[model samples]
Target: MHRSVLPLVRQTLGKHPAMMGVASAATGFMRQMSIKPFTPANRRREFQLKDRVESLHACRTQIFKEKGVGELPTIVVGGFVPDATEQVEFQRPLFREYGSVYYLNYPRHGFSLEMFFAQLADLIEYLNARRQRPVLFGVSFGCGLIAQFLKESANDPNLKIRGVALASPVLCTADLIRPEGEKAGGVRMLESNLKRILKSAAEGSEGVERQIERARRCFQALFETGAANRALTGRHLSIRKKIMHVIETTPADGGYQRVLALQQLDGPRDGEAVFTGPTLALLAEAEDNLLVPTSPTLSLLRDPERRRHLFPRLSFWKVTSPEPDDAVAHASLIFHHHCYNPLIRSWYHKLQAPQLFAVI
Candidate 1:
């Protein structure tokens, strides 16, 4: 009973029956005001428009500055997945490689081709406020967008880029995914079942023991692009395994922008781009050719004899690990950063040399 009704209880004890009923009514009113209802409604739909907005707000450009750095900040555009929220082995090694690092973070749903270019351009302009020329590093699908951006801004005198590095280059999306027939996607190269296989291999289970065993076999074949005998191990091999799983398992809505980008062909235009300082292409040991195996654009870029016909100066390096045990897979930079960062560090330093040294 409410303390406020205690006096009423006393008063009603000696009162008439009619007065007692009135006191009972007062007590019920006080009780209603003091206590909560038995059942409450839950209105959250999780990823309702509001939740998407809130999650997106949590993502933004993350900056890591190497102390005492001033120019040519390296900006890395990640593909598909945003750098993991926590315990992500992918990002943060770039700043340690050279100067400041500008890593793009996509709001859960705000990532798109147009958004990438806009955000990248804005970041460059913002940092250029102090008159610095930034270098661009593109990873996976990000390579396609950067290539297109370079083509579009080829003639823009105001847009001055120092150099570019493409990791596991996806110069063309149609290369990764091809339209097979009308009824459903073939059966294209990157099959959906691959995700299940990777997941099976990464997180083993007795329920799917047979499938897990099968995937472990195919998983080794995944490294066939580099060396069939290479059994990967070390620091972030397991982390890379998780990243590979996310790439294939990401929900449709989560990877909508990238999936949409897969349809159009962003082929490199023969003699078009202007900012050709020091373009470096780093292909993962296991992804040297499997990705975009028949991509004419990538083939042209990788062909040393023909690439210079387009890019006046270029450097191509296949990322390899000195220690045989390091798992230098497609997302090799994050998983085995030690293998790639020093190369990037050296490349960043070379960008300061005179034009004569720009060519390999």
Candidate 2:
């Protein structure tokens, strides 16, 4: 009973209104239960702010200072999860030559999309105030946030972005939840199923808790032996352990909420029309089973009409491995240093020479 199957089951049971209501109620209760009270450890490791900045949703900002000569460009990394500090730190060296890297954990790993956007806006303003136009590097779900930010700030004259690099971007949430079929119908089915589940499970608090526990177990099992874990090869055991820790510590309720938020996204089409800066989208060569498949991403970035219309200065790269054993997947893309480091460096060099864009 992998967590991936939950959506499928909800889809299949879409016709049952009673069951959908029950499931929905149970899911909401579980998410509420997942919220943990603030602790000192969270402040120390998770939400370590670099400077005294006004809090957005009580989230403390963390910036990794770079050791280099002269004022280097700043690189702001939007992490996938609140505990994404490790992921951000791992890529610090890659951007060390370019600029300082920074990341902030969400307040208690629970925030609405609007709040998240506000947090990003604050960070962008903080950098801009220092006369720094940062190169945004968004990993996983962070990619969606970055895309939305780009769209929202398109008209802001003060916000000058150097470039944007997305690694395994989760552009659309519906693609991840709904099965391969009619997109509209799939969304309706999911909604119906959720309502039915919530209604049927609208029992006393204890009963709902029991049902939530059952769902949690199913999700845990899915992560243990699911497509998402398939990317964790022996070479990436360390990363795998960190991922498992995140799964174990973070509540599935919050994760699913994030997924729901992503499902509502339409990507940065309108913003892309106005965004003339350099953009880089990195996709895994192999099929991504964890989140949405890479095909849609490739289609979005590779389609000539869409590319020309959306990302005029887009550089799309499909990361591949010569050896089957060394193949990279969605989760492993961030850890694939040998591959991404050079690619990022090349892109940074290109950004440095704006005249090259005119020549091409």
Candidate 3:
């Protein structure tokens, strides 16, 4: 093993500790892994659609089970990092509590948009028939999707979305500009590389294996950039190590945008009216340091007017310790530690807790 590269993986995963463990567990590409896909009584289905404006040619949806007479609360997981292939790990524990779990892969990587949208509609309808409200959990692109759904459902009272949890939620496009914002060098590099890979793949300039090679490099580049950036900036070693590990194990061929659509992926539109649900906003300590926590962004849900106008029920927490060994104060719904480790139980429970209603 490239011991020198371990630092990169540690830093990246350490910064986003909750995701570190699962990401570390992603030892190889999804195709090579023997783990079976989640199956509902209905099994899973895939769909494809074309987006003329975005030039998004495809999308997909995977279901674990079919609808039944038994009513179980559904938990939806959507957020795919190319390095994090085993997304199931994040929800398997939650599924133990919730009746069922459903996972969606965006158009850029696993499934296409048309498939994802169609399957989501079907799942929502199925849940309605059973009188069960599914807990929507989304990270990054999925966060935006959840927000859009909430906004659209504002008029539909029957929409059975009971709760929403946005982990490391991408709230603002500006946030991407830096490791703290959309302009972050790592993100820009990954985006540019993806566009190039997509162009080549679409041209059929190479065989399936070659296309996969391009994808693997893209994922590696993203992870490496993140790790390198942290190292240069003198950030924590855990984040850097995690990033390195991700780059090391991530497959050269597995596509991510196919899993998490990048074009459709936009941070919160600037100046858009704030929207809310039973929302838990997670902020990483390193990220907070990179981007100053101002009133506008920090007050995402604290202001009464904003809370009532957007999400009447909103809570916020800042993750201060990305290392479990660090003697520091921990907050509710905020996790700070190594991702591959089990430091997120409290944070996870806090997000899922029913006690948040009291704050709302």
Worst 10 residues of 2 by lDDT: 38-47
Error of 2 at 292 (Å): 5.2
Q: Which stretches of candidate 1 lie over 4 Å from their true place?
A: 1-68, 82-94, 178-251, 323-327, 353-360
What's the C-alpha lDDT at position 66 in model 1?
A: 31
Error of 1 at 337 (Å): 2.6
Candidate 2: residue 29 Cα off by (Å): 37
Per-residue accuracy of model 3 over 173-257 as CA lDDT, tens digit each: 3333332233422444334444455556455635434555655565555444433423322232333444345444534333544
What are the TM-scores, per candidate, against the unseen true structure? 0.60, 0.64, 0.54
Each candidate structure's count of clashing pairs: 0, 26, 65
Residues 113-157 of candidate 2 have per-residue lDDT tens digits of 655555456556666777666777777667777777677767777
lDDT score, residue 238, model 2?
Answer: 36
| Model 1 clashing residue pairs (backbone) | none
